[model samples]
Target: MERLRRRLPPLTALVVFEAAARLQSFTLAAQEMCITQAAVSRQIRQLEEHLGNPLFIRNHRSVALTTAGQRLFGAVDESLERIAQASTEIRGDASDAVTIAATICMSTYWLMPRLDAFQQEHPNVALRLFALDREVDLRAENVDMAITCGSEGQRHGVRMAHLMDEELVPLCSPAYLAGRVLREPGELLGERLLNLDREHWRGFNWAVVDWAAWFDHMQVRGTLPAARLAFNNHAQQIQATLDGRGIALGSPRMLADLLASGRLVEVLPQRLNTRRGYYLAINEHSTRPRAVAELQGWLERVSHAAMA
Candidate 1:
């Protein structure tokens, strides 16, 4: 303990550094830490000085971590998560609330619709859904579990289970397809397409199938048509599709209810399997262990039913 106190940089500075490094933006780190951008910068500078290594490559509009920065961040983030978990356990939190984080589209289109059954089954457990368009630190955010789309792997202090593979098909409102005879992929060139911007999705590590990728997968050989509508997130793009604006690539498993209800229609018999999959990640040291376990079991059963 004495050695740690002497050797470790200030915990506050480490917190600021971790936020800035994880976010890759001093301004965002400041906003999250509830401090000024200058304060964040100063803490980062002090930490770098303490470690005798440059931590960040400051850019005109952004920041990138130096190798040293990445290394420190990996250690700091995991350590903080462990500390937080230990503290929570020590406190013996008695809340029965279970929080699950997921992508906005998955929450809105898939999980939200099916939550009633779970609620009915366990009336005493309160469920909170944290829906965001971007990935988040599950332990840092105090999320008991998260449904994410990515390759299967162990994240820091988290256990992951494969939920389902993402299956995409061309979808549009029935009104949009009424007048169009899209017998082949090439015929789609004439129609207005709704798309999620690939550039916007890069940071999230999502498996984004842009128009070019979809066209190439379908073996359509020509200059693909420009998207008439591009959304920064899936929810907006899906809304536009539902409003009969344009056709979009969407998951059949996630939107199965919508398709069955005739709110949307599949445009082609073929499908694109992006090879990416949705995963359920649970914080192994959650305070509400029983609640988390119950939700995890329910999610696995529901997802398996969907895939079946």
Candidate 2:
């Protein structure tokens, strides 16, 4: 092992190189590996230096593998696949459960309500759910499935299916509306608006529609009103909106039940559709498991029905 370690470049760098070569884009590789593009470049550079040979021809917008890169990629890809298969066989079905990872907001507002139906349909399949609010690596965490929200370009190298596009609209409890009329977007300037604390999510790079962006989209020119309240978590912000604290920009997919039950109502008729949406991401290593496949199919059917 020591001799092999000295003869080879870092295993992590090899993995990163394989992703970059396979995807043909550092940006895409970074997204797939859950790292920064610069980090991917750095790892590739280190591997190249160790081998004393250039592996990639870097162009302005894309990268192409050199002959040496092609050879190394073939070897590394096969070795990794074998390792993954061996690991799976060794682990076997000792812990048989379809483990799913998702954002806290997604788990609470979107997924939790539908779980009972899944249980009823597949009674013998045990399930484990992890509600995380930060970025998670499906491979590293050994998650069978993940509910991810992002732009199309950002999601690559995974068997994914479209769930729903992000649709945002101003929402408030009926109590806050209280026989008042809000016809124009400008009228919202007079009401208390709930928002997410930008400082709290500084690292997450959350690009959700804020009051300023919503106003710009509506062509309401002027200084935007300050937020009446702000919370670090989306779930908290949603709870405040439900409590009639203020109107909030809400996603119908997340608040479908509330809107249907009349607990939350759209303040204005306008809805903003962004290019981003939710998706079901299946782990590449776990695709062969029967339970994983069943859950994936269920999610697709359920999401499609909801979107319809």
Candidate 3:
């Protein structure tokens, strides 16, 4: 048994050897495995040592497998491929769970409000929400779906569905706007402007929207006072605006409740189109499971209704 244990190659070494042998190039195998070519060479050497045979003949710029290496590669490659196919099939048929990734502010203000309805409608579906600001790799993260804010660009193997075009409008506490009668967008230049800090505004390059951008977009001239207070989260910024702190550039959906309750009022009717917008993303390699499909449908419906 001890001799057999010594004869057996480590799983990592086997994986490296199989990849290198099949591709006939350590460099290509390293690229596929996301490791250095040196690492792949070391692993294959270790694998050869375990089997007590030299696996490959290293030429000036290429490697060719030995007769024994070719035989082992054929068996190992087929075995690993079968294992991968089985795992994928099993994961696809998993019926009890669905995982979704969304931003913190969207999860808090948007999804949380409507998720109960989804639960009640689809009682058997166990839903998990991962609230994060950073974009997650759907396949790598095992996420069934994700909601992201940005322009659609080079997402390698993901399908993107446009959710909505986000528009930013100036908002302030109703009390703050009550006595002060500012007719046009220019008037807001004199009032205090509250800025949501850089973290929440990542990918939004317009510093003018950070008090400077909004004013510039409105074509308002003249110097303005610095931001009265800066918040890392939109929720806090909205709360401050509600408390009559200052005017803020608010997302139409984020301040829906405050607008309905008359706590916040639109400072200007004109809205600026932001470069960023919300989107639904799914892995192209995987079909949407039933629960994930249902959730996606529900989100689209809710977003459309909100916009309407």
Candidate 4:
């Protein structure tokens, strides 16, 4: 072991090389390592001398990784990342933030309003919310858990616990319906309808429920009205509704705060159950199951209250 250690290049030299290879600039590596640029250059030269091979090809104003540098970088970068993760785990701070991947609508309308109370109750348990429309790979993204909107079998390799089944109901801001009345479900045909394009999604075999199904379920026949507005997702759809853009189909459980605050109103009592639902997907490597489980429980309570 001693002989092998003596034969190997210095660990510091490898560290310097890793940074330089990643940044592709001695100056940037120096800034990252809090050392002079000359020091980084010297370390790289020493490493090359030890290995009998050049790792970087230095030009007048730029540096590029040599074939050898690329080979070493792939391993070194992965090793350093693993080391950092291990260090974090060893520290084991109770206040370490757990990351949650939330959908656009869920993050904006449903989860945001309830987050403050969760923080207040568990001050030591920190939280981080990643809001994006696309479904994320939990393990690859280093996310602890996710709030997904789809059927139970949409995602694989992760266990899901149903938070709430999304019920489609038409909603509009009070201003949008001013001087207009909705005596029945069909009365909304005269109002400007906000529709989302589900054509791209129709290509996938996922159980995506849309407006046409809802209209058919309500028994409202052909040639109702043209869409006055269109949106890509429920988040923007709800915002447009709030801004009086048009009447949008929304989940009552998710839009309860707006309804209670009088920012939005339900168009009619008729609501359709969609194939989609909100589920909590737990990562296989997640260490903070208790924190995520608490959040799941809180959501169940909130959804029930909203429906009530």
The number of the candidate with the highest lDDT is 1
Per-residue lDDT of model 1, residues 67-155, tens digit only: 99889998998788788878877776446478899988899999999899999998888998899888877767788888999888766
List candidate 2 stretches off by more than 4 Å.
Answer: 1-52, 56-65, 92-94, 154-156, 202-206
Candidate-wise lDDT, in order: 0.87, 0.83, 0.78, 0.80
Q: How close is candidate 4 to the true structure, as a TM-score?
A: 0.67
Cα lDDT tens digits, model 4, 166-197, are 88898899998886778777777677888876
lDDT of 1 at 146: 87
Q: Which candidate's TM-score is highest?
A: 2
Writing each residue's lDDT as its tens digit, candidate 2 over 36-138 gives 9999999999999999999999999999999999999989977886787678668873466778888787888888999899999999888889998776666
TM-score of each: 0.78, 0.78, 0.67, 0.67
Residue 151 of candidate 3: its Cα lDDT? 77
User: Which scores better on TM-score, 2 or 3?
Assistant: 2
The number of clashing residue pairs in each candidate reads 0, 0, 4, 0
- Deviation in angstroms for 277 in model 2? 1.6
Where does candidate 1 stray beyond 4 Å? 1-83, 86-95
Candidate 4, residue 116: how far the Cα is off, in Å: 0.4
Runs with alpha carbons beyond 4 Å of true place in candidate 3: 1-95, 199-209, 285-288
Q: How does model 2 fare in lDDT?
A: 0.83
